[model samples]
Target chain A: MPGGPVNDFLDQVETCVPALRRYARALTRNADLADDLVQDCLERAIARRGLFRPTGSVRAWLFTILLNIYRNSRRAAGRRGETVNLDSVAEPASPAPQPGHIALAELARAIDALPIEQKEVVLLIALEGLPYAEAATILSIPLGTLMSRLGRARSALRLATGVTAEPHLRTVK
Target chain B: MSAVTHDDLMAYADGQLDPGRVGAVEAHLAANPDAASEIALMRRQSDALHALFDPVAAEPVPARLRARRIAAAQRQRRGRSWSWAVAALVLLSLGVGGGWFARPLFEAPAASAVLIADAINAHTVFVAENRHAVEVGRDDSAHLASWLSNRLDTTLGLPDLSAQGFALVGGRLLPGEPQLGGRAAQLMYEDAAGARITIYVTAALPDRQPAAQLASLDGAEAFYWANARITCTVVGTLPAERMQAVSQAVYGQLTDGDVSAPRYRS
Candidate 1:
């Protein structure tokens, strides 16, 4: 908090940039546009730093910024109805590995195919490693909602990625 | 053969189990093959999820994503915006003051200071402009004199200083800060030696009273006066005696031989 609201706001945004970028990337599924979303989010955050000081955690504050910007773009796109999603989840290059479980690429597609709400929570908690409480706070949902979303997301991912038996399950310890 | 709930199994797979609660869960899972299989699927799911996105957290953060730089840019942008607001406010005050005083325009104690500052600033900006040495050329001295006199409501006459080895180099109209007439006409005079002096004049303040004083400010000597007609500040770096002589000559003629005019003594 040294150097007042300006500095504190900056510090907060800085600490959250990476997470914000990752979330944007997951939401938009495009690296460049994700960063664009991040940049716009930062711009709004900087412009309205004064509004946040006594309110949200800097992380939640930033996520709120990113989420609003994302939603607005989505709404605008709805108006245009021309979304190509041209960059939806590029396939990573790698030789295919073992079976009995869902292949990683198929799993990725499954995660991508989940509705936005489910995908957002699963990525925030399971992927981004944000706690359920923090994810709930960031998403403005009750913890139960966050838990249900996570549960449904995992169930959807299992169905989509293939829930066939895999021997590695016993070695988790 | 035990009762390990799905919530507990999911929590354990996601690393949410308390250390103390883990032993009991592990014992229960070890004894139940079906329960163990369910726990295994959950662990595999968590692992697959991590395999997909954890590399992101491990990747070298791009420069654009660097927390410090983003923060720095954001802070700078915010500070710049706020400082701009402050600057606009100050400029607004200056503009309002410029309109309010509306008389000789600048208040007295402050008049000399402001005039000296303007004299210095104007000298700096235009002394280098050869073709535009004066806003109104000396050749059009009549217009320069009349226009300024009307604007300031003072009887202003351009002095012919040829008798004193100096010639009117011309004059320019300048916007002065409010306290100092808000509008000023700077009359530049140069001697045979290229030595220069300027007389800054403004309209008779609304008070219509006359006041005269002298001071040395920031390397410039200023002789100033306010009359029912106008306020004039004479500024230069000449010696005290030279300044007095120039003031006497400027006052003598610019005042148009008004017998009640003040005398010359530093």
Candidate 2:
């Protein structure tokens, strides 16, 4: 019920687009579908500006709306027997060059192989840097469930990538 | 110090552990190398995941993703005319005049407050109708309950208020504030005297916090409460005691022994 100028809402939403696009891209693994999802989310939020509460942070609220739309579309796509094309998944332009680091492509596949529930929890917490409480709220899951999912997801990724500690090489900062 | 648990380890890796607990976790890790290595591995996974996807956040957003442009386009498509704007401005002035007198009371009630107002508004609009008071009538109460339950994404049953001298008159779905689920179901009941009351229900709000509130507008009074399952508001114009009795009956049946239902904020 925090009524405000529409322009202000739009401005806040605009600042969030880059992060939304990033999260969507990680979830969908395809750039075109990711942008499309973000666009749909932005449209929905803009249309329902009056529905947003003034008490909560707009960022968390926007993320919740995005996740809801994402799940609905996924369900619809599932019924139609649609699957994301693995070949279309985009890779990051630059990956960290740490000694004995897991290959970025391999890690991406490991993440994609995670169960949808675990993938959502991991990406929201790891990639979006959302607090556990906020991420749980966005996913509509209890905090305990979110932590468990994160635990299972980290183990699954570690097993998939086969990461073991390599001898530390001192590097200049 | 209490022993560190797996949850604490994960929380520490995620940077969610409180600063006071950081020393304990670090001490535990130093004494336990295996635990230290496991935490290190978790951090590595988080870093690699970031390496794989963080660049996307830095990429230039496409022109189509602009929020302002999308909003403008949406407005153009809706094609709202000027008269509606003029009328809204007039109403805004009237609201300001009335609201100024009650400014202390208008300090922006919580989301439940907004929902109660919406429920009352819906009640007032439809309770006056004769033929179209409800989309699904009492004869189909069973189906009405199921349909609204599905739409609202929560289990709902039609509370039998006959003991309170009101019979199920039917219910209809209405657009609700999206923040409180985008849809609401309004069930109308008419007493033998022809007076009617409505119970407005929506799926639990985002926080799922228990809340209750009462508000009166234009002679209509609404008693609203939200538990973990759903939010229900009973709206009517009956005398205060009669209204309270009806609200209590509806609350008892709908809450299903939720003994800790929060009291309405005055």
Candidate 3:
């Protein structure tokens, strides 16, 4: 019953579940599947707690496991002939676009359409708000590669949302 | 000041630029409206992306995804699998132990039943005794061999099992079933690891039938065979393969010229 360290590990994992779920939802655009992915990631992290290195933060490690599971499942799904479940695709409920904000629904689709590699980098940094270094480490990409992917993703998103012209700002009374 | 690069502009938009370079990038943005607007679009895209997904995090987590629950489920699964492993081992040993004890009842001829039982019993009783494992120690092997040969009324040469890592540990006489022979000689051998094996020898049964049989009795393997000259059972609690090796060697040497004796297998 050496439960102290294991309990601490589970507590740390519990704190990261929300972020994992969010990242997974953004990546898959399917709420149920995203939570399933998060569950799988958490189970794997718990099972292989011994293999976890102490040098990296638990958040980064969890992210790494989540992304790996996500990619592997995608690959398996691809091999099985991708099943696009229309019911499972979560359509973002967005409000009417404000002056400074781009269309959130359009942005969601744009993010989905980006190459998976670029999509991962964009979501890790922009959605998760992880530090550049940590996102780079989690993605196992060089900082330069991360930045370039971010640049490509932003440009792609901007193009997809048709945000080419600056909107005129009306001064409020 | 180093002129801002595209990467620097992107990093600045992302608010990831070094603090020292932030002032320089701000000054560059003030003088450069197009660069400023491009940075603005990147920020808007980031904002839109977050707006699209951040609510997912705010939703209450489902019970199935709880970390403690998952850990508990995994522990339960591991415990069940371990119990299955232990249960399998118990069943396996039961199967082997049952087979080891039930062999004589099913396979052995009535004559071999008594002899193999006697051989294994003698082996178990003597091998455990460190000081008195052999009545006549190997130092008196010549006298012991001849004395047992006279008592059993057969010229019994002590089978050399050194190739299989067992050496002579001398022998003694034991009273045996009168139907087979009134007396038997038990020649003991010991390996470097102190594992002992005994060869139980008796003059041929009344029938003088040439026969060969193997049985696992009481956790010991007894390889029994008879030729015209005598009946010999090599007994040991060694592993099956090692016991087979020692048994094969003894069978080959003891039944050398007895052409009627069948060769041992396993």
Candidate 4:
């Protein structure tokens, strides 16, 4: 067999790594599990090789694969009753930002609390930095559906984290 | 722009609006603080979310997530799988067990194997392409490079293959095994004999190890390798000697003394 496709796959995975980790992080709410998820995703992708290819952008294709793997693993873990806590793993953005709303720990929990749909939209757009078009394609939803999910995700975070107060941190950009 | 709907406003906030409508949205925003606040709120949310997560992108990607490693793991996997297949064949020969009886255990072709095959297959198909070949012309190398690079999420360098008498024609990113790496880039090069060669590049696997392998397939001689930086497959339908020369030239130039190049036997 030619080594070309393997090379191509490797290169593609390299680019998708950050986004995968980010999405994994968002999904599992555990950096270690998220990385494990990413590793599993890559292993499965490489091991499976060329069989899973479907027509369309590979970005969407890869995301779909990763999402499926993540869901399946989660289901398997649930069945096994392997439970773990994520509270101790939480880290703040800065030494001291404020007492309440701007606290990143609170925000992380809020994000963790979002409905899976809203969470998926936020990660695809904000965390993964995927284009709306690509993210919508990956989610297999209308662009409008994606936007609503994103909108709801943000609103929920603002309420959940008690960050309702305007930042007053206006940016001229 | 005339009393833009919520969708239109959302699109504008996301920076997805057409240029013609941008001014109109701005006009609307200036007139409506309420709408502006909504947009501002969305932007802030985006900013905060980015603040919370974008760092993951810059975090020195873990070695386990490296492309080179993933590719290496994949190659090893293929070898192991082939051996497993051989063992299964042996078992069947002996009529000892039912390992072959299970379909899911050994039936489906792995994505990596298929992608590598497809990349080689596509390389053969298009390397023979002549006039009106590549979707993007080589003259627009800068655009093509940037576009494909952005799509593939890795730096794309058009290796100077001129010394081998193969001038770059252009390249197009193709979707490959999403499981393997998700995307593939095909760059076409033409030589004086009207012969062609293609260099296929993809993101490294999670393992990011290197490999040296050569596979002759479908009238094309393919020299493929993986490295920390990228996985490149050079494919063309040239005579074995000519293909080796081309692959060697490509390996030499693209590596640019950054690392040792792979040697192929056949």
Candidate 5:
């Protein structure tokens, strides 16, 4: 059977699933809910495949859909007064923090405390490693606004993790 | 070298600065210890974020999040719904044979014609089956009525057709024309002789003008009527008098409270 265009569209979407999951995990800080969000995003993308423009990248389009769904769910959860499960935040086993290393657990908590908008910017650029232009498009914000948010997010994170002051290193002559 | 701004330092730290500007930013960082320290801290912050969430990307993706699987499931769902109309069309063609001849007693309005065709198609497709005739069986008539009423966004009580020798066989919600409120409810009734009839209903048309038409389509009799509240089509292959009796009964019960309903005439 000739799967053709549909198969190609699905293949492209499949490639972006990992990053979508990663971004969602960082945003929600809960693995199960993060996967649920990804699943919802993928289903919507597949359903509205016709609406997707050929010019935009699939990954960026998927991120836009994922963010819209995330915002909607957050709004609904807010109305229900839902409590987030902090324990669900995946804390990978890491070596003890060195003098300059930000403690992983502390950083995760700091991320949880960041405003939703800033957290999104941080994860898209820092965690997913998307280019500033792509991340800005995904967030539907101008490049200048994205930079400012990233700056504010970095400052908040630095203060939250007590990494605002850097270690003084000897300068090489 | 131009003065190194905060945005420049941030871009350099995030590894996003233009390639040509990188050299200038490095020179500024070398001359300014404080700026250098700030850039290091920003890089570390990015590192720390990756450390926290990168594992989520590296981990094996769950099957549910697989795009192809989701697409396949959605296609199946869409196909199932579309199958109703396709199956109806096929059966309608078989029942009508070559006689695409449809004689209308009155000028069949375009909206009423489509509704009548859909009603007869639904009736032709489901009436032949011994089981799986209705989605919500007659056993749950109360729930069926309320559910169909809620779906159609109007107060839809199950019309009493028992007096006409046909018992309620229950109803199922069907997707309807987008212009006609985009939803339809099909209520099926069966007589002692195993003859089946279906009443298709939808919210009122945009115009909400009252209309009534009787049409012989695809060898089935269809009585269609619309009021301010709703538009209904009753379809069956029963004899002329029996079909008229059943349609009149359904029309009376369904449009009982709607003052705008025009009187149903044979």
Candidate 6:
């Protein structure tokens, strides 16, 4: 096989790796497991390079594969009775922040509590900065469904964070 | 001009609204404190999500996640599989050329095992030979299909796997074990990535019993199935799911109108 397409494909995959790792980490909340997920996703994508069309964005395609692999792993884990303990993982180390800052740990826990559907929708749009159209496409849902999931996820986060007292806290710069 | 909906407010918060509509949404946000507060809370949630996860993208990526390295390793593995196939072919030629001297070394492996080995060996040997991958090319697919069918004495059709991203590279006949059948037809297919797979088919074994087997030898994977009329094995180094998809497509086409045969799978 010629090296040109393979090289190009690898380069495309390389560009998305960091973002993939970030999304995987956000979803799994374990560094090692998240990396493992990314490795598996990359392997699958490379092996199936023939099926990937050049017209579509490689980033979206990689994200789609990553999400599918994540879902399958979660399903397998569910069957095997594996449970993740968010409390057990070491907390992210950040020094005390200014007043009105959202407690990172509280927000993390709130995100973890979201339903998987809403969680995927929220993170794809919010954390990954994907357009609503692309996020909906990646999730294989209608645009309306994507909107509802985002709405519900944000509401759940707001409730769980107990930030109802003052909703207009502009992010602490 | 029109009453702004909740979707419009959320779209504004998500930065997805059209530029022309941005002014209308902003005017509405200023006029309605509740709408403004709702959009603010949504934006805050997005900002919090970013704060929680954006650092991950900046952290040094692990070595295992490097795509170039992964692709290189995969290429190395494919090369290794071909080497093993070549070695197997050398051993098989020894068994054939030396006859009685090497009989013990080649004593009838399981029929499926022999078939899978032959399929993979043929796949490795011919796939690398760009100029002479097959005796007949896909351009003469009609003649190739019929000639192979006549040679094997079983009805065979050219399996179209274009849907699965593989196009038939055509086929050639090869010698086979007398115990099962004296001849086999090796049909090759190539995908856009130039990855090649082969379907090795022959007349059924004497007992004509249905059998299915999946084997991963070296790096290549093989899916073999036998029916009353014919035996088919698909061999490739593709990942399991992709291999399954190609094998499934091949099975569907070749087994058309034959219900007795159990579906072949990976």
Q: Which prediction has the highest DockQ against the true structure? A: 5
- In model 1 chain B, the worst 10-residue window by lDDT is B96-105
lDDT of 5 by residue, B149-257 (tens): 7888888879999899999888999887787788999999888988888999988877676666565543666777777788898888788778877877887788784
- For model 2, how does the per-residue alpha-carbon lDDT over A83-139 read when each residue is reduced to its tens digit? 776776555465664655666777889888998899989999888889999898888
Residue B200, candidate 4: Cα error in Å is 25
True contacts kept of 4: 0.40
**Global Cα lDDT for candidate 2:** 0.77
RMSD of 3: 24.3
> 3 or 4: which has the higher TM-score?
3
Question: Higher-TM-score candidate among 4 and 5?
Answer: 5
Comparison by TM-score, 1 against 2, better one: 2
lDDT of 6 by residue, B202-231 (tens): 888776655555655546677776666788
> What DockQ, between 0 and 1, does each candidate earn?
0.11, 0.28, 0.24, 0.25, 0.29, 0.26
lDDT digits (tens) for residues A29-116 of candidate 6: 8888888999999989987889999988888899999999999999999988977767534465877634445567878998888999
Off by over 4 Å in 3: A1-3, A85-100, A168-173, B80-266
Candidate 6 stretches greater than 4 Å from native: A1-3, A87-100, A165-173, B81-266
- TM-score of predicted structure 6: 0.55
- Tens digit per residue, CA lDDT, model 3, B31-129: 998889988888877787777777888887775686755654554345433433432343243232333332223332456556765776667668778
Task: Indicate the residue-level lDDT of B119 in model 5.
Answer: 72
Tens-place lDDT digits, model 1, residues A1-173: 12455555665676677778777876776677888888888877766666776554788778877887888888888897834453455565656545545467777778768988898888877666776777788788997788788878888877776564445541221
Question: What lDDT would candidate 1 get against the real structure?
Answer: 0.66
**Tens digits of per-residue lDDT for model 5 on A26-108?**
88878889999998899899999999987989999999999999999999999989677788865658786666778888888
Residue A79 of model 3, lDDT score: 86
Considering summed lDDT, which 10 consecutive residues are worst modelled in model 1 chain A? Answer: A164-173
Per-model C-alpha lDDT, please? 0.66, 0.77, 0.76, 0.67, 0.77, 0.77
By TM-score, the candidates rank as 5, 6, 3, 2, 4, 1
- Residue B64, candidate 5: Cα error in Å is 1.1
TM-score of each: 0.50, 0.54, 0.55, 0.54, 0.56, 0.55
Best by TM-score: 5
Give the TM-score between model 1's chain B and the true chain B.
0.52
